[model samples]
Target: MHPTIAAAEGLVIDWTQMPTYNTIMSVAAGAGLLTVVWLARALQLGKPARLEGYAVAFGVLGTILTLTGAHMTLTWPLAKYFPFDNIIFGEPSLGFGVLLLGSAVLLWRRRELPETEDRARELAAVIAPLNIIIVGLGLALGAIAFAGLIFQLFAAPPEEPISGAFAQWPWVEATFMSGMFGVTGIGAVLFPLALRGYRAGAPRTAWQWIVGICIGLPGLGFFLFGALNFFTHVGLIINTMGS
Candidate 1:
């Protein structure tokens, strides 16, 4: 089973199947634009509107989708045998590319739905802050993603059937995916809690509880992940330079 093979798509291809044109642009646009829109709303820079909320939500999702596609690309070297190889190239563009573009376009087009002051206040006082934080973390993740893109471009081509710890390391991929899940998974676990929070009359607070856990606390995990990555990389650099 080729790691790049897609039983879903019914064919296979290499991870570097094509240039990063479509996938990279889509992901980056999602993260970067959405982050901007969210931060603006959070800071009260614009009129209270659904566009702001929508932007942030799509942005984080875009960032996640891009990360998934990017990681899947690593299978070329990492895979013992990629099962989805045929599907990778045969079907179409990289994973979720078209859907993302369509969603972004639709989101942009549908920004002006009629709503009430009550809803505006709710978006402003509640979802903006939390969504801002989520989008901001997404922006950070997108930046880290550049490392992989650079590796694909400037670094020497992997040894045919690339070897070394990187080729075999599942933890690297798992860590990235886990980080994304930990942040958004809260929403899945606490949908009813979120609805309750929304309905309980959007009182702004330093912490919002969702599904029995404080939202602010779970939110901190994304920052912690970034700090850990920075220090780890810095330590590795210092050790290498010393050697």
Candidate 2:
């Protein structure tokens, strides 16, 4: 056994027995997919009522993800993995959840005003100022995704006991996860264009389609994976961390 893994034997938290990790991932997945759909609707139809519905959805999912992610990030429940899992999963989940929650609040506030009827325009205007920050975050996510890919592929192959049942598939698990991260990174990088197109009232813009696909695919994957983990993670935790 690796010295790290050996040291972590009895100390590692068993995520399978608890719903915390699964719940967080599931909420993140829901929020991600909802954001993509909301953006699509905002870009295409720009319907006020529909957009407001999405805001409510975001508020619910975002609150769940934000609370769970913040707890995981702050408390570091999975202590064996320490900062790696915290950085790769906890921090991003917290950040995106907060973003979603904030957007929901902003949209909800706009809806309360009698004069602010054009939600699409309001959305575009609200996000435009943050384009630079969004782009920077995109770049950072891309960098982290790239580093994760390399680490998964070379530094920590699935054959390592750490992978548990994933080792049975060799590099397949790593590839799928890395691919998800890659597409999500691409979506983030191109999201500014979608915002720009919305601001310009161009519904059929290429950026919308591209970003939608990029974000939607991973959102689905994460949702399904999180659901699956509800059943499979017990074996994984035991196999990798030992009983």
Query: Which is the leading candidate under lDDT?
Result: 2
Q: Give the per-residue Cα lDDT of candidate 2 at 178.
A: 65
* Residue 214 lDDT in candidate 2: 82
Per-residue CA lDDT of candidate 2, range 1-243, in tens?
A: 111233343434443433346435664665566575655665457443545766787887788778777877887545454446656666667777777787788767766533335556666778677667656656766776776667653232232343344555535566776677677778878888877646424446788778888888788887876666555555445545555
Clashes of each: 19, 0
Off by over 4 Å in 1: 1-57, 64-69, 73-107, 115-187, 196-208, 211-215, 237-243
TM-score of 2: 0.76
Residue-level lDDT of model 1, residues 1-243, one tens digit each, is 012233343333343342222223333433433343343333232345566466556655555555545555554522334223212321122233333444455556556644433443444344333444344443444433443333331121112122112425534544443444344335323333343434223453322233223223333443353334344433433322321
Query: What TM-score fits each model?
Result: 0.36, 0.76
Ten consecutive residues with minimal summed lDDT in candidate 2? 1-10
Q: Give model 1's TM-score versus the native structure.
A: 0.36
Model 2 clash pairs? none
